[model samples]
Target: MIKVLGDSHDKEMYDLLVEVTDLRKFVEEELHVLWKDVDEVRVECQSRHASNGNASISTSYIVVGTHGIKVPKPNMYNNTRNATMVENFLFGLEQYYEALGIVDDGAKIANASNFLHESTQLW
Candidate 1:
């Protein structure tokens, strides 16, 4: 799903935030655990706005199903889910950088950052 991120850099950053937020939710919900109390998770998203107005963002997520649990490689037949996650992440990064030239208003930066931070509180 392609979204119009922003007129400039802020828009691109906003999109990355949205993508990370979606991916986090999908993993938490779709990949349910047998015992919720037995697991811990960490999600990190890095976002920046360029001075030239083209900044990109990236997110890394790790889930520990149990104490020191390792993530299993997806089976060959189920690559769709993995592809979706990758697509979402890359799309967000691209849109964010694309906005650099378009994000001219200073106030947009504050608003963009606030929205992204609030929306993607995956920590």
Candidate 2:
């Protein structure tokens, strides 16, 4: 884990990334309880070089209240700071949850188990 300092917007961005991680962890745990059928629900944060090799999306989660970006392929010689990467990453994550129809309200938590079951269904 890398440590960031300073109170600039960059720091704010880093904070946002931390928040994203927390949210992912929370959701993953909820999934565990909500969907008892499966014991393992892996929420991965992947960061790799892009085909073209520009900047990479190192962050994979963020707060739903703000812009949530997802993971992007890493770029070579990209000057993007970690904080900026994290903020954009949150935006991506938000998009992912929206696509998955994941509601922030606690109402859906109970149905998480069913959600998982349906997600893996071949039919």
Candidate 3:
């Protein structure tokens, strides 16, 4: 289960919960674009073994800020700092427009006339 919390003081902001079997798919499809507005996220995971073995459960928290993302060191029982998982999560948040040849240098000028007319009305 994953829970997302928005601004605390704002009543309009609500919490979101997501249950998933695959973390990679959830990160790429749902969380990639949601990083813009989400302030904090909590993830809970559980695994059950055979009847003779014990069950295990763990939780992790991730905080998002303007400068970057923060993930604390795992506790004694929980170790979720796998290199591959961290790399994948970071890659999903990256903006690759330039590398993908999607940049448009003249995009601003294309709408410059409309912007200027709107700006004049504001005066």
Candidate 4:
């Protein structure tokens, strides 16, 4: 997610139309130009969206281990007896991740491996 959208100017009055609408439009226009394979951007608009978005997304992997919320672990997958409820197991796992603030995919997979029974661990 974008932490900040645009540059901050102390002397300038807060103009929603210029700062928000126009800046968003400039980014959209640039994206359209890129989609069209054109480099016709002659007018450079003041924007910090790229760096702000990158900074936020780059630090996204640093996940908080827990948020102090109670989330019961899903039932272990022992055999085909619980295979019919596989969807429930997946949903519970997702809730566990969200409640525990687990954002990194690698961490989620590694932690989820602990919930798998020996009979289903190969899958």
Best by TM-score: 4
Candidate 3 clashing pairs, residues 3+ apart or interchain: none
Models 1 onward score TM values of 0.22, 0.25, 0.15, 0.43
lDDT of each: 0.42, 0.46, 0.34, 0.64
Which digits, one per residue and each the tens of the lDDT, describe model 4 over residues 1-123?
233433344224466556888889999999997966543332221133244454334323435667556777778756555655777777888777877777766567767778778968887
Q: Rank the candidates by lDDT, best first.
A: 4, 2, 1, 3
Model 4: CA > 4 A from native? 1-61, 64-66, 81-84
Angstrom error of the Cα, residue 94, model 4: value is 0.8
Listed per candidate, the RMSD to the true structure in angstroms reads 29.1, 25.6, 28.7, 16.8
Pick by lDDT: which candidate is best? Answer: 4
Model 2, 8: alpha-carbon shift in Å? 0.6
Q: Which ten residues in a row have the lowest lDDT in candidate 2?
A: 41-50
Q: Pairs clashing in candidate 4? A: none
- Model 2, span 48-103: residue lDDT tens: 22332333222222234334445332222223448876566445554545655454
Model 1 whole-model lDDT (C-alpha atoms) = 0.42
In model 2, the Cα lDDT at residue 25 comes to 100
Ordered by TM-score, highest first, the candidates read 4, 2, 1, 3
lDDT (Cα, 0-100) at 98 in candidate 2:
61
What is the per-residue lDDT of model 1 for residues 51-119, given as tens digits with 9 covering 90 to 100? 233332212112222444343322222123478765664455434433433233343333333323333
| Candidate 3, residue 75: how far the Cα is off, in Å | 22
